[model samples]
Target chain A: MIRGKVVGRYWATKRIEHIPSGAFLEVESAGGARMVAFDVLGCGEGEDVLIVTGSTAASWLGGGKIPIDALIIGSLDETGKSKSK
Target chain B: MIRGKVVGRYWATKRIEHIPSGAFLEVESAGGARMVAFDVLGCGEGEDVLIVTGSTAASWLGGGKIPIDALIIGSLDETGKSKSK
Candidate 1:
């Protein structure tokens, strides 16, 4: 898992239906590199997060297929530890 | 998927049996970053490959559990295009 900060939201007015609603976010890694990830966890801006990427992300919806390539698996508290189930 | 070069091999004489045999390799991304990835495809050193990560990787064995966090899913040819199914 990569530790990153929730930098902002992604507004895609038109997108594939395979993607679940409210599934986009922009995360900036500790190294300052940013990438868009699907928000499985409802994280707010400035919150630290754990990012799970690749096919693992696409499989989160179980047998159903989704285009998500990265996913926010966990939210981190101020102490940089995961705070949610 | 992230494209990376198979820089080397990882030898762990003692490992969990849940992880398939001959499943570890070292991959270096285009940005010069390196990480260990499980080799689903038989990739050799110097080959460029595609990586899949997260829980998706752990789920590749159907319902069976594995400790893999990253997986090499495809191998690229000399022209920088995927050469394997």
Candidate 2:
């Protein structure tokens, strides 16, 4: 899983139902990977987050196929930014 | 799937019971889905990660959507950082 933050959101009103949900986001990691994220979990702009990708994405969606490549699994607090751990 | 990192995390005392979970992370990928992912696998600062987006994210997860799409499936060691891949 990649670690990054939700930079912004992108939305397409006329998208397929099983295609993908929520707004699109930009996540940049310290590892040098900048990825786009799907479904910002109420994630505000400039919030760091985690992301998932690949076949693991199509494992078992509600009897339907989302066709999307990523999903927002959670939200992180300010604990990690401390740099004191 | 988009590539990124767990820039930060979130911990909600009370959520929608099924909207989203874990700490939200930011990830950058070659595919260009700056996405927030779910289920980050013990990722840390400056770690590059892979992300899955859309309905592709909700396959099983005990059988639910957790809403706010995006999931982090795996972790990358230090090999990808060489910037030579």
Candidate 3:
């Protein structure tokens, strides 16, 4: 996985039903590059994060129906442990 | 998944061989919070990202041998798709 931060957020009201509820976000990679991801935890701008992508990530989002590659699966704590259950 | 940024990275020189080659990262949630994760792609500072946690995440990291909960599985692009193959 790649490391990064949440720089901003994006919205698209028009989407599929199986797509579930979430928003697309602008992420700045730890390498100092910018990117985007899907968020369900409502991550605000400027939060540090871990990211996952590809067919595996899309599968985790909801199989091939979602058309989503990047997703926020959990939040971490200072000790490298996930804060959310 | 949780939205956040890659604020920092952590290293543990003494670890199991199965732990793989990577570092722990300090992440701040998109909700303006902080957390930690394992990084494999060498994500630097101030990057946005998405994360996965729990047993499923652990399984993805190294099939229970790595003791890793949070991992950086992929990097995202301007769109919500993965940057790495």
Candidate topping TM-score: 1
Give the candidates in order of TM-score, highest first.
1, 3, 2
Q: What is the docking quality class of candidate 1? A: incorrect
A1-85 in candidate 2: lDDT tens per residue?
4456676666677766676445678776645566776753577787755555554434323434667565554555555442211
**Model no. 2, DockQ:** 0.15
**Model 2 chain A lDDT-worst window of ten:** A76-85
Note the Cα lDDT for every prediction shown: 0.64, 0.55, 0.62
TM-score of chain A of each: 0.82, 0.70, 0.77
Better of 1 and 2 by TM-score: 1
Per-prediction DockQ comes to 0.07, 0.15, 0.05
Q: In terms of DockQ, which candidate is strongest?
A: 2
TM-score of 3: 0.47
Which residue window of length 10 is worst by lDDT in model 2 chain B? B12-21
| Clashing residue pairs found in predicted model 1 | A56-B56
Candidate 1 local lDDT, B1-85, one digit each (tens): 7788876554543222344665456666787666567776688888889887766667765523344557787887578464333
User: What DockQ class does candidate 3 belong to?
Assistant: incorrect
Q: Would you give me the overall lDDT of model 1?
A: 0.64
